[model samples]
Target: MNSLQKGNGSVVRRVKLATIHLLALGVLSGVVVSLHAGEAISPRRLIEVVDISGPVVSPDSSQVAFRTEQASVARNTYDSVWYVQNTDGKTPPRRVGEGGVPLRSSAGLSLPAFAVWSPDGRWIYYRALMDGKVGVWRASADGSSAKPLTNDPADVRNFLLSADGKTLNYSVGATRDEVIAAEQSEYERGIHVDSSVPIGQGDLFRSGNVEGRLATQRLDVLGDGFARVPLLSGVPDRWKAIDLLTGKTRDLEASEVPSPQTIASALPKGESKPWRYALDTVNHRVALLTRVGDQGDLVQKPGVELSVLLGKNSPRHIECQAEPCVNKAISGVQWKPGSEEVVYTVSDPAEGMAQSIFRWNVKSGEVRLVARSAGLLNGGQRYGLEDPGCGLSSTALVCVAADANRPPRVEKIDLETGKRQVLFDPNASLAADISADMPVKLLRWKDAKGRLFTGQFFAARRTGDRPPPLFIAYYLCPGFLRSGYGGEWPLATFAEHGISALCINYGPFSFDAVERYNQGLSAVKSAVDLLASSGEIDRTRVGMGELSFGTEITMWTAFNSDLLAATSITGALLSRSMYLHGSLKGKEFISRAHKVWQLGSPDETPEQWKRIGLEFNLDKIRSPVLMQVPEQEYVWLLDSAVPLMLDHKADLYVFPQAPHFKFQPRQLLAANERNVDWFRFWLQDYEDPDPEKKSQYAVWREMKAHASNRGENPAGSRGD
Candidate 1:
């Protein structure tokens, strides 16, 4: 008989006569089977994936408390709700906090984002905006007795309960008022004044000939562009340690908190963005992905470091890039279930290099190889902002797991032996519910430059005779279902409509403008050629789309190739100036992307700007395009969009003021919905059922008539 370890450390075994239990379950409807995957995804079932986020298993492992958010048409915003379910998944998750007053954040973000169960399992503590700012709130396990647990003046970004269940630690960002006051105080004290002048803006004017600067040598920047932005102060997340029972907070002001700015700039050896820490009190240890300053050269920069902390002991530095170590950034880490061992993931940058998982034993101080090409396929985010709660259970780890042939799946990995068990199947169930898996296969190829590229493809089924229309949805999709709430392309939804989706991941390009553009664009062209050569997807009906970096690539591809029949983009600035002048993050991204390809900075290499800049290449675009950008980002878009729109070759869609990564669910859903409509009309000639889309179709049909008269067809002419 098979044996299993229960959460309470009791051993359970299957009876000799297992057939009787199966017969009983078959006869009784009340006896439920867990993981009853319902149906394949379609436009109708898009809501199914929306509510499956932040599944937190209770401390006892008997139940799970997860957060769910849905786009509400009636309310014109997304609504956040919590759900409780048995760990076995036998029972359908039931919504909690019901009939209580609904809560929404002032920023239109859903409330109660991350939910964690109290040690006693009698309460669930979650982050929710109370009176315009986020604070911790607790609700009874049954969703009643909802009350505030902490009253912080600012939004709490992250919080966690200590292993002993006595210390509650959290982090919060500085508020606008705090930042302004600090700036004013500094100015009054004869410190540097904040200025609105753009970085390198003065250098160009200081030199009589701007062209001379680009042609001859690098312009000396007066100061770092982003570091000058007072609001962009590179402060670490401010932490607060609170006594759970007394509600007494011990803040930075009371403690000897290290100066984040000084620590960040002078990090000894660590070189990533900022240090992030996780505490495991049971082992009296803390783990941090951080950097330290070099004593010889304060300005010398380096990569990040992985270190461990023991009680009153200096952090035990784990050499991740030395002999007997991997030369890559530590991707993720998790404490072994009921143990002091830390499991982590890391990857190399070379082509065909797979992400690997490792286990570091704190007591033994030995890092053991765990799994190679590990669970990278699951849980995607362009920026790893929110933690997806990838952790361990009593005996196994429930996380996103993947392999070469299969996409990511919710899997349970044995913590000790590393054997895997599939807990949820979003693919095969779709095959059972619909017609076939529209089986997905890994697509591997090389660019003209011989740079290796890889992605995924959905095999076409159920469509008769006609080659499947192809749509390329991109931006570093590594695994199966994604974790974030916004900006995700509707891949499965496209597959359900009988259109095959090619999720392309390109070469990790450096910042050189030409190489970045060429290597990435060539990879995409190669993927398309492979698909077309297979005679599985129609070449003429090809379409492409992206948000953020993908949008920039789409523009470059449209300019470089006439292969795409249609495209959608989010980056719609009139010149490279906006990209160079926008958010610090965007500016750094542009600079790094260009530099990687041997391209110089804009101030030093104006020629490269003229080549890869999207605004300069609009005339070269043969495919019709759709421009969907946020209102805050429309400053330079007018000059760009009017020219494209005036040609009747593009459409400009303006959304409410929202950051690149932050979009209201309603807006995100609407964008995806409209994208589907645009592709359907242009690539498949399938008019949408919604009447609101009729005018759009009419315009598309008129464009079609013009194209037909000119002897062009996105889809091959039926006459052919």
Candidate 2:
């Protein structure tokens, strides 16, 4: 049975946190602890926090629709729920449909895939996965009922609704004849070996015994050397439309479908060219938003230029009179109702990464501030009313916003007064508990290269006179500090257990891969110096955790400097073996790798390979390393991990059927708990009391003994 009550003119649905603890502990065994007032966040609690996204306003601006996703350990996957709330804050949000759409790309789940509201504001339509098939679905806004609009066999990748609400157009993947033939061949015979399929893709096919052999076979038969076809390539997406009046569906001709970018025209030529633009049909003018710097330069000064083009007249640049006018970037550009004004959002990195909404009068050329946020607006990377995570209306702006401590929540801002009202908070209780235990402080520092960088420092409560060990997670630290980008390391949990942590954002990168790695090394060293000088942490006991690009930097730091006591990476390293493995993907991938890494065949570029390759620098690394990666990436680690394992300096664990970013609840919990244990053992010389980890501690103890025999210290000491 469930219980609900009324709060603030809305129904508040509450669940017992103890139930979550029990469920998590029962599934993952020793991964979660009981939650209580003032208790610190655990690995399971962080995974269970609701991730809210796709906030879209109704056609009449009377209500907003959004989705929430949370990890379900029992199901071993994520569950998404959609809800509808009145924009006026007068009524509580209601659960609309059974679930929201599941939109995934090659990389994995893409969030903020908005649901389209019906013209009459009575029904909201979205794409969802049912019985392993993706199709369009709709639910009554009043939460009375829900049903599917399209039941196509092929997965619908995208869709659009006509203004009149009488028609809906959708696009789905169409299998090619070659693909079908290849699949049939694989079914009858084993997979055929070839260079056309990437090693990762081929391994996936072989592991699942599924149908990915066609693209590779096609390439092989055609002898299309240097030309690469994706592992799942087929004909272009086919479009279909449904007529609501007659309840009929039909294929759409190419000419009947408009281009995806019909709203914006060609970009103008200039140093500050706009990355995004919009057209005003009513006034016959255009609005462009540009960032003032080289598009590829990461450390350029923060500045933006908003210009308007009226007829054939010269472009007019709108002047911003507001203080702190330096803008890092601009997004969400659009013409207001009646084309009287243009509205856009600007993010100021200098002001704690604050975002503000501004309106520019086309006729008078006056810029006025509508609303501002000390944290993020709309979402982290993109900011726009048209964005799936935000919506705009004549009288208000609704978006998903959050800061370093708070989780994302739906907030409605009054357009006129700039007043903000919280419409819904999905993680209120969890956020409160975490915030109380671990407080964040914004940190800014410049590396030796004079490049500016920012970070979030989560301070731990000191339990003794000696400083606590510091843990560093690198790459991007935007919005909430939810264990960095991949959520691989539990930052709050670390701080609660007496390990201070810092999440550093990478600065401008160099085209030269070696120099870029050096930059990351400098940034990490600078951060350690800053915290140590302030008596906030013990720099000698510093540990690091990373994913993707951060893993590269961690390796470089380990080889180039002895600043790290222990390191954990959730990715594979780049090496000679990896280059050969990547060649299986095709010529284009190999070409891109050459350009990015400036590496060729080892026979041709021995010096280049020896300079940055992991295999060549393993002898220089003194810190112990932990490798936890997806099964797809596990093979790439063999070159380095095999050597390190023999030397008792590394450990590797792989998650089956996992993507680059692990999404399974059990896998995520295991990774998180393993990371926590690894850092504690190396940095603090502490071990968990759980008896299940007895064998795990035994292996580490042996590694520690081996390190001592080699005249090395696994744990940091006062004197080297």
Candidate 3:
């Protein structure tokens, strides 16, 4: 959901908060509340209302702290600190600090997320854009005395505090240093596509034609002491590292001189992009996750020599090269605490169902199962992806688990015994009160290309023989899966009204694989054909709901199929033309491959985009369309969606203060309750009042109030 503003500027949408029952959490203390798997959960009362973002965890796993914002239409965002005991039924969750006012340091435009407790358990370290760059800031774990950790001008990506808690090892780099350096050196190298910046600042003097290498440092815990590591030197496509402490220089890994034919042959095919290749490091062994081919490789250090980890496999022998394998699934790989055991996540898009945690011993290279998740446990849950959350101190593994019918709950599992403990149960009480409808059914159909396609269908449990009015959800994204759990409003809320929802899983979309591109678009037609044959769905009453890339699929489906009665879009694309000035992180592999991108690149594939970019083909979208654009999206979709709405006369509105990533707390609550109300009006002809529209968003209200007294946005406006 990258939304581009008018200029080159871009902003990531903050995370959203969903309601959690306070009474339920209070009752959760001291009680081992249990329910059969897949039981429907009806939240009694929101126990702890915390901003639902980031890895909200406590050091000891006893308590969890998170950012919760109170939403008001008149304001943009209202942020506050919230903490609650992580157990069953005992005490009511309480807000920390002065009443509802945010801890002074936490005030800002973005939602409060990425709340991480320091290793010492006394302070929390998070990012605050103070003093020109987003630097690390420390706050009392109880929400007090929050201040900047350093005034250095560096953008912090991730940080790690040393064992003694005095030294912090964090990775920070110049925001556009690489791009700027490359652009500066472009003419000298005559456009070497592989131009990069490496370490070694002491040797500012350059070899002929090579630019002075940009300085990258691996900071030591000691204040004012640092060392430099060069990712790329002036040398074309070379990696070298310089040890600042010892002043010794070394080559990181030598480059392979592939033949020109090999390079050219590796180009993308059709709408498919080449796979991103990387040397996967596991202890002493290394493997490559490559897009060019399926043959996997294992490499060792020093020589940077590669050996095949897996070879070509037959169709039936549990082939491991593609997914649910070591190369593709593992990320943030690390050794287990006090042991040589390595841990990683085997995430597979096809499995889309869940991510299984796997552990490999560094000493023996022996792999074992650690914890399996029903879906991605990391933030990937939103993108329908998953990764492992190793302990900050290397003792425990943190995981998130959920499925089609379950809201996720955070859990920590011990690597040694395989024992698990629940940290945050999102639906503990709801599970006790109501029975969830039957588990969603999975289906597989063969495509014209002889490939088997998989999808999920969830029907209302209400008894009746009448054909259910099926709602098809369109999906597109490299990080998410069609089967992954979406928000409660469209799926669960709609189910409560007796409408069946069918989620069409399309691939070779970004969510399935980056290299695959829009390969899955071909399958949507077949999926619709199958649904049309199903007697249980009323084809005339079908509806479509799309978010992000799903918006593309929904538009395609609606343009082609007369079955759909209406379409709802959020954080979606308005047109391919919008991508011209679109703000995508171009360093990513997909963006780098111009030829592959052009295959689906909205600009080059204008004809194709015109057919699918609902904005241009509105006449084809006879069904009333509801288009929503998040105010905080990476790209100003308003440029596209709003204009298209005006052109097609579609019903369109902006969800103020909401980000591309998540909704405001109040917005989420209202969305879950009232959004479905709007759908029911169109589907069941059920009457509901006009949804309340707030003049000011929750975030803006907070900002204006703070401005009234402080004379500026809490984060400081541009003019300030």
Candidate 4:
């Protein structure tokens, strides 16, 4: 028999007879059955879920090419694969090729660069690793053959296909300063210490300059490099055009290709380009989703407007029938085939942030709704639709759709009737393996200041008569429930472990940094009180998790209130060390910090430091904190962690070679499992029986005893 203790100090026993009976049945039948069946999602299984991107329609609009990425634990990285499927759902999606270099933007989001097809739709061209070289490779549409198209010394960052399909335009270059640093390191010359070098990068012998060799020598490293050389910004890329028929390459001028600024300049005055725009060459009109603000301002209001410019006439604004068009942005703007109608997607705040698709006739100035769903449409982990999220055919729009309960799947939506048909589901088997009908409720609440907030409430599976403990993760809750923004807290897994989880989406923020943090704190407090009042959760047993901007809010809550029983944060908090390290990046970083936080040098603004720095507020924090940070960001936490470690109030673990967003398979699994264990021990007084976790539980046990000695009750208790 096994025993578990509830928060009320009641013991529940698990009998072994049921398990024995199942085992005997399996033995008599000569088959093995799982003892733990229909449990909530596990961290290992969640990591195996496939990430789908790029349902790019073929030129003939008959087939679509997409990419799927899944974590490979043995390889410690993601395995990228490509697939092609018919738009009409007539045939199943077939695998075309594997592996590609993903294109990452400055904002750190990975763009779909693996499914670019030729004009004839006979072959797919993408950048991949070939013979230890990063180059362009092509595969037949039928998956019968594949070959390398370019064997360049430098990796091709991005490529474009011409209309005629005779030439391929590609760009390959490195940051100017990093290239110079690589050449200098080759000669054993001492590097010049300047503001360009970010602090805590490395020592002189093995500095960031040496790491630049990865970009200069091999050029196979995915995403952005670790070096923060400020001089790298604004440097133009080297462009080249390759003739497919003649097998020749020649340098092309920068002006040969249109830039974003150049394209935006062609728009009408007082109208600026948003993330996605629609250009109708046949109708001689352009449609843009523009925000309500000046051209170059950093901060803009949430309200947005649709602007249409036809043949240089005054820009006409189209208004939606759904009033109060207050939104951060809209996306997926595409021109209807051979018509003056434009289609786009927006999240209606009045409808619990439900995503809605709308179409507007530029010639008639009329707008009409196409479809509306509380779940996301043409959206993924993030809130809005990504670039090239949906491709429009003559009669239907093929998009990637998902929600809190659904993993991303390719769907074909009829343009006329708005009926949806699933074209492909990559994670159908994985979803079936971890089958459990976890209930999800969309919760709406308002803070004391009248700011409205929305959250997804996941109820505990087996709480009995007692209200379950609640765990909260912030600040964005979109699509799937794998984790919040940073993928730190496992929401569904928490529910399976008898703890209800709340994932809160942020509302509007104030301009003042202090007020912004207070707003977040208010929202969290309101959520807890709302749940407690409704008998949905126990107010005394509450925990929180966060990353990035959410970390700032978590720290503020810990400093100002006694709400959290336990807390976990990934990445660094705001401290004097972080400010100093950021200052080393450049004046631009310093200027932005001053603009946002009003932060300066510690010596210059000691008062402000005491007001906002986590190091200064360490004396007030009462909850035990778990810090699982990336290796690159661990140094910034030293000032705060060292002091907290002395008091046994915090434990820190660093993942080696990890970025702000952990993508490595083993690292992600380790972080997710550790978080689960940490909360289970603190919030539930429970531990897994696996012997591998013996030492982990031992350390936590000591920490619990230390808390008791300090006259503090264990977490999930009735009183402090």
Candidate 5:
């Protein structure tokens, strides 16, 4: 009756981990232990998605073209497919695109999703690989005809269709010499390569007869090209506007370095305010947004300058911050369907701002706020809304509305009536699946410092003979798990096996910022106090887990607080202060992140190095720690990893060449396998579920025995 509720029903994994290794995986291992197919989502079924993104509502509003991704065990990652669905919800979604197109990358089997509906609703235009080349393709709305529209060998990386359905503005990557020459030209101007330099001393270098491009961006050595920064703003790389009817193109963005000032003064001037049409739609006008300055930071005011190009008339600058324009960061601007009102959204999370939606009348040039409910915190990347608060269907608007209690859901905000109605319940299946096994609730609490925080709480619906263990995980956890970027939290697996989960958004969700880190620590404190006082969490069995910067919080909580029995941390490290700036070669990411988290250099933040930085403070950690790292992560973290495993009561799991964002399905399942085992044994004295596994559990047993011998329990003991 409750199969999926109790376990992830059986689906054979490509690289199944042993029971002990699975347990170390923490939350997911419990599902596979007693795996089978069922209604609700389990770790085994984590591959499914509730929301379909990049939805293009057709002109008549009869159909919606969108895409979704599903995990593929064959590829060890997620692959995408496109679908068309009736907006009225009468008919089930008809799958338009399928996987099985072979590709060279590790993401082996599948097609890319660039699907969009043609303005007339007769066809759907998308980019896909065909005959060893990636090009634009189209399919009829009724699914009767499908064929290649553009055959370009260079491959279209990104493209958009014109309003008249006659033009395509596409961008392609730079070529080998193009990339190298840009890097070399920029480097020569910044650093004078005299006779002392390696190149200057070479026999060929002494002569000016060599080819203009000798290989740069390290492409000659690395075999991978790196792009040089553009010399001008609002210019696309290798941009071309093609007339689909004529098979001819006008070069809109030329990649050549601006001619030297001396050479430029001798030449004729071109158009003064060059514009690249972003959406040259059938809607009868061209819309373009250009960065204000070369810096291109979108968070600041006046970040972009908007330009409108009418038929033959000159392009005009649409004032962004003048008399009638908005001063807040304009994150987006889109022309309303069949109207002239330009809708935009403001996302300033640092100020606790919701995503306020506004509209500008192109004829009157008057800007006004239409919908001010972006929620206190916005997961800006989710759902891929063309207009967050306003998707026009003739006179009505479709929106993803949100509030403190509800995650963003599709709704129609009626402009005339000022009333809102639910449009689509994307997560209905997901909500039913997980909620069947676990009772989910929203939790709010105040820390000792008197700051209020909120988080999502989940526990088993039926807690039987023994009180359940607890695990707290967090990071920018706003509203619904609808985006389907990262799979749902392993709450179902955890709850079914007697574990509860609480995830919080650590202050507006900023990366590498000190202010957010402090807020995360405070939120963790509040979570611990609230969960402990509720008496639902087994006092001795409280564990914790974190990914990315959440590891920093894990480090602080493990060392400073005595709430957790065990913990897992990944994604990033806490030892940025251990290495000097620029020490890790080609590792400017580390250097920048370090500066954002602290001041000056590792040498300057010695005290902070010991407090929150690299020093590990391993001697003080009360909970057993587990750290899983990807191969591509920086090496300095390994320096901290050794001390954590060898000296402290911690373990490490490292995946080869795995990207930090997510693991291959095989690796991910194994990781979850290990986590479930870790929490199970530490919190409930449960051993390996599979009797065959030995070495992994043996090591953990020794760690537990060692701790037990010392008469220590991070949280209250089982004796309690």
Candidate 6:
């Protein structure tokens, strides 16, 4: 200003005046504003997560359709939609056109989801909301031209499309309330979720043919833009359509038949009882699956022949074309690609666990050995039947094979020459990617009783070294262990972090839901004793983790036993009492809830409930535990669950928003990573104690160090 020229004097004065005005404004506001954030941010900051689930491949197999929620950058919440993407995972998926997310309310929790695909794969047929109500909608493969396919008021259970894409096949209904009542009865009788009876919603409708108007309407693919068909299948809604073109939907050929007294005497008690009904297909063939006392048999009428499929002599081979060709030697059957031939697993029922694959010509009634892929007819591990859908082509079928120590391996079978090739071997993958030098052993032990129990042990690569922290996972159902859907992360993630893992199957001693509800305590005890006796598991450093109903069992052990050094219970079954009262305490198997809770409900039997709750006796658990709950964890933990644990001072973490299921890869990965770290901290401490526990100044020094590393005031920063 002092050096300003005469010609610019007015400009200088104006600039000084503007500076004074800015200072005045700042003084008036009494706050300083900056564009960038400071060092620390909120720990609760929301991150966008994707739900890439229900993968559907297009006819060309070049594109895949899936459902997920996309984030609103401003609002910070996601809306659901059907999206399409390249199958190779190369391209990012885009929405199938613009539409509002279907509102999930108390009236119905079922939202529109991917259901069927058209013949050409150019369109993804789904049940979505068109206005404010629920209905079926179809969208182009690329998320374009989304239009309604059905306008049924009742909820759509599932859907199918004709090969020509001109007809849409679907089933619709309300949840089976009666089936739920029956389930409640079992729970009341001390049956847990796993032990409860399984009743199909269709069973509720089985009283008669679906009580609905039935007729098929031709889908005009090119006209009407998009058709909105009414709800078809089941009772109450009473809207159904029977296609005249394809034999996809029609009335039953015959009523359900009662089990013969002899068959009933042979059948297993409880839910193993089977119902028989006839499916009226194009050929007027009748299909029946019935269970008697201990024996289950499947018979197709017109042929008036039967084969046992589940209980005794469970029929595996049945040619249902004209002459009824029945073979007691077969156990599992799958219709071939053309639906002409049936591939069956044939073996002697008395052999316990053995079988071979055979092909039966339905038209010719000729049975021939396709392959002797040993254990095809084996009762225990090989009970899973081969189906034509698993085949990559008309000539090859995909099969899964497993042993006690290893997970199942996928294989392809050639029908013509009976050659077999391993498609993807989990065992080989674990060895190659995890360790080659480590001694991996599959061990079996019998508890005090003579029954056998199986476990997998991964010893240190070097000789004579105690295995790193041993972890156990009850992945599969006790009854279905060999081919069960095992727990996902504990086995693979633990290996990734150089930790030894043991997968224990608590089967034979207690198999199926009824056994699970009845004998969980004994089964767990047996498994623990067997594992400890082997001396392979570091008894002092062992950690346990399980999910779904397994979480219920694991928590029971954590509460009662001091064997586990650390534990994780995801999707916990915290309360049985609430589930039965229908107060939304937890999600339950519709058919099994009624009778299952009586034995374990805290309200009914205080002592038993105390044991089951795991909260009342948290002090008994010596291990540092981590309990993660999803935002909507009604499937397991209810409103009372978290508070009960908190009252007991249990270590817990809550995912602000998450689902009951574990199909999300990222969330699962994060959980696994945290588990590995927690176990490592506890187990590694067993070998080397943290010396920093000694000095008083050590705490301050560590704090300062942390602050320096974190580049923030450790004492002041609370991550926000």
Best by lDDT: 2
Lowest lDDT sum, 10 consecutive residues, model 5, at: 1-10
**How would you encode candidate 4's per-residue C-alpha lDDT over 1-720 as one tens digit per residue?**
000000000000110110001111231121223324464477766665666776677888898887766666655655566777888787777677775533332112334444677889998887765444456777788877777777676656567777788888887665434555764674476556555343442233232211112221111112112222212322356788889999899888767863433435546766556644667665566676666654332345556676666644556555443332334356457777777677878765544456777777766667667777666676243522135547677677877776666566778888889888988766554345333567777899988878888888888865567688889986777676677667768787888788899988866644467777788899899999999999988887888987777777887888889888888988777677777766655566566566667777888878888998889989998888899886656788888988987888898888764545566667778888988988888888888999999998887777777888989886744421
Q: Write the per-residue lDDT of candidate 2 for residues 557-579, one digit (tens) a residue.
A: 99999899999987677766667
TM-score (all chains, Cα) for each model: 0.69, 0.86, 0.58, 0.86, 0.67, 0.51
Q: What digit string (tens of lDDT, one per residue) describes model 3 on residues 687-710?
A: 444435333133223423443453
For residue 268, give model 5's deviation from the true position in Å: 25
Per-residue CA lDDT of candidate 1, range 530-643, in tens? 878888888888888876557767778888988788888764432554544533344444553343333345666667666876666767877888877754345546656777
RMSD, candidate 6, Å: 20.4
Badly placed stretches (over 4 Å) of model 2 are 1-36, 175-184, 190-196, 206-233, 258-274, 278-286, 291-304, 309-327, 337-339, 351-354, 379-389, 584-587, 716-720
Using TM-score as the measure, name the better of candidate 3 and candidate 5.
5
Q: lDDT of candidate 2? A: 0.68
- Show the lowest summed lDDT stretch of 10 residues, model 2: 1-10
Instruction: Please list the residue runs of candidate 3 whose C-alpha ends up more than 4 Å from where it truly belongs after superposition.
Output: 2-23, 27-163, 167-332, 379-381, 384-395, 431-445, 476-489, 510-534, 571-616, 631-649, 656-662, 666-675, 689-720
1-720, model 6: which lDDT tens digit per residue? 000000110000111100000001122121112112221111111112121223444655566565543333334323455666554434445567433343221111112234466778778877554444345677888655887655555545445566687766555554334434443564466434222111111111111111111111111111111111111211332234435245244322223211223434444343243333222233223233432222212112111233323333333434243222343434455545434555655443223223477665655666677766322312113211111123223465554443322333444567789877653332242223233333345555555655555555555321236545566665442211221122234454454344566555444322233345334445556655665566644555666766555566666666666666566766546455334433322333222332333343445567655644555665565454556654334333544455544443234555533433332334544465456555554555312134542442333234334434644322112110
Off by over 4 Å in 6: 1-280, 286-332, 337-341, 344-395, 398-412, 421-443, 455-464, 477-488, 506-535, 574-594, 600-604, 610-613, 634-649, 663-665, 686-720
**Superposition TM-score, candidate 2 onto the true structure:** 0.86
lDDT of 3 at 378: 47
Greater TM-score among 2 and 5 belongs to 2
- Candidate 5 ranges with C-alpha deviation above 4 Å: 1-41, 74-77, 99-114, 129-133, 174-236, 239-335, 340-380, 383-391, 396-430, 461-467, 482-489, 508-516, 574-595, 714-720
Worst 10 residues of 1 by lDDT: 1-10
